[model samples]
Target chain A: MALNIKPLSDRVVIEPAAAETKTASGIYIPETAKEKPQKGTVVAVGKGNKDHDMTVKVGDEVLYGKYAGTELKLEGKDYLIMREDDILAIV
Target chain B: MALNIKPLSDRVVIEPAAAETKTASGIYIPETAKEKPQKGTVVAVGKGNKDHDMTVKVGDEVLYGKYAGTELKLEGKDYLIMREDDILAIV
Candidate 1:
């Protein structure tokens, strides 16, 4: 988590949760059938934009859209960069 | 455009601009070659969320991400519904 990543106004950096490998019934789900993870922990937050304030903070668990954010890799880890508005809820 | 559609909570309704059919050099680009339009006019907007205030308004021209928003059809016209945060800049 020490890759020195910073987001701009109204943007955030997140560490995505791992996708589920098994179903509730204990049935194994193949890697190709697993859904993309939609939850993550906030790693960094930017200052509020011209009109939007920074309400979400680092360490907060958040839910975002399935297609929200841009994916990137740093230090062999995955990260997502998205505007705060892309977040659906603070879990 | 009177489809009676309304957005809720930081969402907005937009009418996408038509895709370009011609290149800048006066070459006619086939329908399959045109890029999706990323600009649109706001038709309606929702109230801001608890932590975010609505800064965009109806009739405002906006720039958005290429893949942003959900597309829907109403009254035989196409529309896009997206969170206000998806809007990049007011044009």
Candidate 2:
């Protein structure tokens, strides 16, 4: 069951564990040997904050840490619960 | 030459590119085919913001994204320039 979660106040909703299978060198990494990329697909994004301006949006692919944001599981899929500040880059 | 940077106001200095090399299945991945983990080590930590309380410090292993934070290089080592908020978990 996919959740229709709306992030509040500079927070972003991310689908975790969706990582690229290859490195920049074009090597094929098996799932059993792949490192967790600090990457995700933006499912939902929150409004900008009063202090810092928000620059990302939904559907934007992003990079972040494995242990950076709070982890939540909805319908068996892992998702990240993080503030906008925790977001590192938009790809 | 490593930089002794003092982050200002809730920013965190992270040494990027240091990630776990194996998946849960314990497969051996070569560096040539590893995905970028959104994980890093806290090199320097900033003081808490006036609004949100700061909870992490230097030397803490943290996770973030490849595209989540700003990137910087010092003496060829890639580092991440991010706010404290970008840090997701403390490992």
Candidate 3:
């Protein structure tokens, strides 16, 4: 079952991919060495905000910056993604 | 000397802190294991977007989420942080 989320205005809630801890060389990298992933799965989406009409919808996978989206911990799991403006590109 | 940047509208340019590669135990982590840092230094501040009134200024150190901000590789260095709204808290 997926999360039931209704974004307020143009905000979008994305379920970030769990960062990978291994390299192409099969090296088991530690938590202190991985670069943030720019990809995520859309978990919940909000209605378009008043300004800057919303362009994304729920269940839409998107690509963002490594350092993108506000970090939020829900149900012991971390999730983020706010505002369509914050989203750089949709995959 | 710092890079000259002028954020467009409500966008704020933040110089993200380099992700730490070592843990308290002195374990060396690889590029595949570190959690993104939410802290960053304000490199350049935008004039605030039209819809959202500008709030932050230049040289303001701010804190964002791990997955926050669009990624940009400038001069071989990766940096991110955008919009005052994107910023969760300013340090």
Candidate 4:
């Protein structure tokens, strides 16, 4: 949880929810068929832009659109960097 | 521009900005090396959800993340569907 990256201008860095490994019935789901999880925890936040203020903060669980954000790797850990607008809802 | 598909629940459809075919230096860029455009025009918008109200309207030009949205083909035309948050700034 100690990364030096700071988001700028409405950008955010998030740790995505872990991918589901098993089905509701306890059957193991293959990686290829597993739906990519759209939920994540905000790790870092950015200052609001000129017209909009950010509504989320660190540690907020958020739902984002599927396929949103550019994937990144920091110290062998996966992260996503996206504009605040890409976050759909705070859960 | 006459598509009947309407976005729902803060989802939006966008017509992406045209990809750059030539560099500012007038050299033609090959298809494989071209950067995807991150700007687009909003074609459709959805109603705001419980915690958020839609801040964009039809015909608003927006800036987005490089990899935001899902690509779709509608009536032989290309479109992107994404949550309202996928849009970074209105221009």
Which ten-residue region of model 4 chain A has the weakest summed lDDT? A21-30
Best by DockQ: 3
List each model's interface RMSD. Answer: 13.4, 10.2, 10.6, 11.5
- What lDDT is reached at residue A33 by model 1? 31
Docking class of 2: incorrect
Expressed as tens digits, the lDDT of each residue in A1-91 for candidate 3 is 5775566776778887556533222322223325566546678877664565655566765545556678887777878857766665443
Task: Give me the TM-scores of chain B across the candidates.
Answer: 0.79, 0.72, 0.70, 0.79
Tell me the spans in candidate 2 whose CA falls farther than 4 Å from its real position: A1-91, B1-3, B19-35
Candidate 3 chain B, poorest ten consecutive residues by summed lDDT? B21-30
Kindly list the per-residue Cα lDDT of model 1 for residues A1-91, writing each as its tens digit. Answer: 3335446558887888777634334533235534678777898786766678988989987778878986644344677778899998876
The sequence of per-residue lDDT tens digits that candidate 1 reaches over residues B24-83 is 223222243246776577898899788667877788765566778999897888999999
Worst 10 residues of 4 chain B by lDDT: B21-30
Chain A TM-score of prediction number 3: 0.70
lDDT of candidate 4 at residue A40, scale 0 to 100: 79
Alpha carbon lDDT at B16, candidate 2: 60
Kindly indicate the candidate among 2 and 4 with the higher lDDT.
4
Q: Which residue pairs overlap in candidate 4's backbone?
A: A85-B85, A85-B86, A86-B85
RMSD of each: 11.4, 12.9, 12.4, 11.9
